[model samples]
Target: MNSESAILFTQCLQNDFTSLLDKYDPLPNSLHIGYAEANRLLGEMVEDGPVFSLMDWAYEKDPKQLKLIHIRDWHDPKSKSQEDHLLQFGEHCLMDTKGAEFVFQSWIEENPNRAEIVNASGLNDFVDTNLESILKPYKGKSIRVGITGVWTEAKVTFLCYDLKTRYPEFEIAVCSALTASSSLSMHFIALDQLKQILGVNVFSSIGAFTEFLTGDQPNLKKRISTNARIASDKLNLDPKYPITDLDKQILLYLFRDCKEVECKTLDGGFSGNVVLKTKSIDHLGHLQVPCVVKIGNRDLIAKERTSFERIQEVLGNNAPSIVDFCELGDRGAIKYRYAAMLDGNVKTFQKLYGTMLDGSGLDRVIDTVFGEQLGRLFEAASTEKLNLLEYYDFQHKYAKSVRNRVETILGSPQNESTIEIFPGHIVQNPCLFYETDLLDLKEYNAISHNTSYVHGDLNGANIIIDAQDNVWMIDFFHTHRGHIIRDLLKLENDILYIFCKIETESEWNDAIVLTDFLHNQEDLGIPLSFDPPREITNEKLKKAYRVHRKTQIVLS
Candidate 1:
């Protein structure tokens, strides 16, 4: 060959043939040696020829060598495309006279009886016809079955029916790209029935069917068992129905037993429904019982609707020792067996202490009565102090955030000139505390001085010392931070009113001694002067007093 053609051939041998041989395993013995010799010969030929005359000389020597030239040109990356790769190679192989003759000779030597050696180089031009030729062999017996988009019940049913009607002989297998939404179990069930109807079988993958048709079941039972175990494990861990009925029932019972009870009904009597009456049996025993029964929907509302058994377990002898509680019916109605205290016989410290009265002796007496029990309750509550602090912080942050959100709703940049006010604005405004100056009142000052832990609402009804001198401090729900003098002020206020009406020297002396004792107590933080006009009136006083007593205790 000429130098140019020889150079091209030598390059092909170096780049393509070297890599091509590595790709194939157990290279043909004769062919491998022949190719290696051809490569060496081509390299020598290129060195001897003049580059200008090499192409013409090569074409004259062997026209069959044109394939090497064409392959070199076609492989250039810049000219390569699907069209160029197939059409160019195909058309050149079929039309090239010398190349076709060489291929025909090789074919004849291999199979002498074969008359037809079709040149499929024109296959690119007649894609449809070429496809027809390949499929023509199987056309009459080939099956045409429908495939489903989603493996739902309806889709699977339709696919089965269509398969049976259209391709009854060949077995049909539904194909699915297993997904969370696809039901493989349902698909398999439908396919199994279709298999029987068509007298064929079902399979998931091509390998499975090929093995099945060849009578080689690839341990499908093992696969099915493994898959079934995985599915069952997944279903077991699902939280859709995690809790049992008994669990829910117990939770509901506990919630009802723990929630605070509020009075919903009142008896038509002088004593209000929410009031409690205290009776003392000398210094030995004291009993405080609800004055009026509060019931709703046939259920009695007490501090809690705890069972008599639970009450006995907790309080032992302290829980209204003489009284008997009976369940009235199957539906939770209850009745208490006890006598109501006589109005005159029961002495509420409120009557003796007076409104805004100071009674240090009474404070000592009441503290003596419930001090130990209160201390225990406080200790028990302290265990959850971290939780309490977290809740307090959350509440404080929430209040500030909500206030900002409400302000945004009430006034925006667009409506700044025409802002409208609502009735709730006065009460809910964040600036109310700063503007009112109520916290600076002298009454608050006296209250703050007299008690660091004041009986926040030291009203008459809250205190009751029976004939036996056993003190009972009731209605502690409104307890708050203030001076012990405030409790004394409240007590003195009540005693003064009684004194003004009856002129009792004993009551006056009691009030004076109590007030002085509260003032002298260094730890009590009592104020020097009694701040009169304590903002609370007889009409609104009860509500105000209740609010003051329930002062939320915030610990820093």
Candidate 2:
């Protein structure tokens, strides 16, 4: 309706047409001849024929102009043939007419308006002179050329070859005097002969519509993509991916949703899921925005679907908007509003910052961008409340697993020396022990505080920042009511991971100290910050060191 929307619609139409046209324009395959070589070969065949004379007639009663060719064999109609003589004559005719009729018929069929060959004719003039000049008038236009007389497969092949190569824009057809039945017989025999003598499968040639004769022929029934057959055992499917009907229906459904939208298939490789992007408009036309269509296996996504439904009920506009959700047999598709302004995430920011925190004027930038934003986030979480009993239940369920994970990493005697894991030790045993220790500390266990709504996966990649610097969280596949500190720690480790990736052990330590200082800043809103080494003891450094070392190992 609007200019931008109209433009997008037009572009979509263009793309759809472009894609469809590709189906008709097949590349030259094994069955097709090289255009130039075909023309030359056809010319040679015609030139080697028994000499023929051409007669031109301008009709007096009609506007028709016709040319008739009298071949040496055709000129001997009056001769009565003995048995052996008749066979010899027939054989000679077949040889001479081999490729002639094919070329003539093709030309006549293709060039109805501009060119015509009324009867068998000698190729002496046409071949000796520039053939290009003879058909020059029909060069840029579609013309119909009429051809008559019986021809062998060899002649038909030659004729078809010449017409296709020399006058591509012309349509060739048999004369009306030649009935459709007669033409069909001629064509059938022509193809048979061509195959037998020339090894050319006319039906398999490029641009030929012979799909109906092949196993790969497309299914023409109307249906959804579910009917398609999966090609291999590796692909998750019912029977297998089909060649025709299902593919068309999918495109049709997509077109119906967003009139001029183009789909980019982003299948979850080996996951048996199909993801696509389309201009967002549902069957009911509620919203006209870009959206993602995720079609997943019903068996795999039942829990995920429940999670999405729950999130929609609880978060409202704080999360991505769901458009249409439907189940098509065993699989389902969910259309959700897509964000066009999503710039990048936390990982993006850290990678961009690089070692800039070590550079001048950047420390102030870091304080403003990260320190202030994180401070606000923590402050926001503190104001939210969670049920006390539910909080304890979550802590109890994960406490033992956390303890085991910590013990496994730190239990090894070889992990005692810091030098053994100095660089990226954060992901190693020492880091795990530190996290587990923090969980077990009396200060953490003694407090009965409200657990708030927290992003379950709070990594930098999950946090999307827009052009205006506003942050948004995505991928709530893991959303749950969890501890506020869990989100905070995840964000901290993400930031630390970046440093470990680019900085040495000393640089990593300096970054860890800076992060600690920012969290401890006055009014920064964190419930608690890293204590000084004298207070928490130098043992805390081992955790930070382990975090860096683990990060290094994973990256390597």
Q: Which structure among the candidates has the greatest TM-score?
A: 2
Per-residue C-alpha lDDT of model 1 across residues 312-413, encoded as one tens digit per residue: 212222222212111111111222322323334446654544442433344454454334323322222312112322312323334445446656876643
Cα shift from native, residue 493, model 1 (Å): 16
Candidate 1 to truth, TM: 0.24
Runs off by more than 4 Å, candidate 2: 1-256, 263-287, 293-302, 308-316, 326-333, 338-420, 423-447, 466-471, 498-500, 503-506, 509-556
What local distance difference test score does each model get? 0.30, 0.36
lDDT of 2 by residue, 1-556 (tens): 1111000000000111111112245423221223322221222223211010000111111223232221222212334433354344332222223322333333234445533322222322244334445455456455444332233233344554566566666444421111111123344456555446544333211101111111121121222233323122212222333222333343343334332444444334445565554443344544455555566553334334334433343344445555443333344445566444332222233433343332232233334323343333334444344454344343444555655665566564333323233345343344434445435542433444534445556565455444444444444455554565555556557755643354355555665564565455563242332333332223334344443333222212
- How do all models score by TM-score? 0.24, 0.34
